[model samples]
Target: MTSSLRERRRQHLRDEILAAAQALIAERGYAAMSMEELAAQVGISKPTLYSHFSAKEELVIAMATQAMERLFAVVDDGDPPRRSALERLADLLRTGVQVQMDRQVTAMHLWMPEIVQMMKSRDESLTQLCRIDAVVVDLVRQAHLHGEIAAGLDESVVVRIFYALFMSPNVARLSLVNSPDPETMPDAVAHFFLRGVAAGKA
Candidate 1:
């Protein structure tokens, strides 16, 4: 019982460390989040942090891995509740944007060769990414078939539109022309994206 309790406490501390790292990465880019800063932020010694994560890159990759796992969970839930592919895709998009803005995370940034290489060395991160791509493309096709999107628009174009609108890192300033606040920015972008693909919408 004592050993089990100790393990649980260790796991809890590791979770706290990851949470701190994620928050810092949101405020500052991954490249800017240092080990010393992370340790200080988590209120742990450098040696303890090192024991949890051998290096910064490893921690960042772990973050990406967790993000991807969550995304897959979102994607998996879509079709099970018998939701339309379009609705499923929208849920995925909104949650994805929230993850990036709030948690400073997304597999999108992991496409870099250095990071990709690390992920590839893991439990098939590349395969997981490809699976996500396949799911997105399939969803686009479903939306097009159901006339949820504009007429005559190719699947690729629709995919690009969805990604461009949903993947804003600095989203607060996104509506400079229309002058919407950060809170309204997400809805505005969603409207624009959907409108472009919306049937009979100008």
Candidate 2:
């Protein structure tokens, strides 16, 4: 095949493999998934699957990276003047939680141990994560400087606390069991955080 054709074929195959893996993860938890089953589901040979992803860990990392990219895109597209930075930050957190509740997202997180191991071995993915973390931290800091957050609050601590709130098991449990509307969760989190951080409120 021509180089262009080869590249297109490769892209198509990768998409198929990712789709199959996501479906499998949704049907059966990530722990139960297997590369062989994924290859079969993608209608590709094991060797072909290996060519695309080498191992299950690489595939999961790619999936997570894709999800994070989507999340950042959402945050980037947010309207700023209409909403405070804190509101935008809350929106980002809510987006992260909703992504986690998603089957593909859950699969990625469920497979995170192996993913972290892979990052340890390769070392590149951690850099990407750090870059993303820095951006998030900066956003929080800017919010405080802009008076969107109280002056006395520690930006770093507030950012960490915001993340913790999203990752809290109670929030995840509420998301999974109650199936609370995704749109509502952000507002709720923002309200709670804002009240605590409001200027002159204490």
Candidate 3:
């Protein structure tokens, strides 16, 4: 019982650290966020922060891994055949954007060149990103097979389009535009993406 309690406390601290890291990364770009500021924000000593994550790169890689794992969970939600691939893709994109909005960041910021290069150096984080790509690739292929997407459209191009739409910064700045309400922003984005990539009637 004592051991379990200690493990839980350790996990809780780890979560707090990750949350602080995300907030800091949102406030300042990855290049500007510092471990000192993170430790101060989390109310933990530098030594304690070091104990949880040996370095900033490790912490940010862990953050990227966690974010990918979260999206993977949504992707693997066991209802693949019940929904259209296009619908599932849109929903997944919506969830991704909503999650980033909740974290006070955008997908583009989290995936800037600096962060992407660092993530590439980490095998675990890279693998998680690849898994997500594979899933999206399969969805794009399904979308093609179902005639929901243009038959001649390259699957790779469609996949890239999906990422591009998902990475739009405008979704995070809804209030600044004459756009739909926050509650409906996800739906609006999904609709916009779908229409742009629809099979016909362009």
Taken over the whole model, the C-alpha lDDT of each candidate is 0.73, 0.70, 0.77
Error of 3 at 22 (Å): 2.8
Clashing pairs in 3: none
Give the worst 10-residue stretch by lDDT in candidate 3.
Answer: 171-180
RMSD values for the candidates in order, in angstroms, are 3.8, 3.5, 2.9
How would you order the candidates by lDDT, starting with the best? 3, 1, 2
TM-score of 2: 0.78
Give the runs in model 3 whose Cα sits over 4 Å from its true position: 106-108, 170-182
Each candidate structure's TM-score, on Cα atoms with residue i matched to residue i, is 0.74, 0.78, 0.84
Query: Tens digits of per-residue lDDT for model 2 on 1-202?
Result: 7999999989988988887887887788677999999988878889989999998778777777766776778566765546766766777776666666564345335335566566656556677567667767877877888887777788878877876766642345546475555656656665676677656565
Better of 1 and 2 by lDDT: 1
* lDDT tens digits by residue: candidate 3, 42-64: 99999999999999888777776
Q: Which residue pairs show collisions in model 2?
A: none
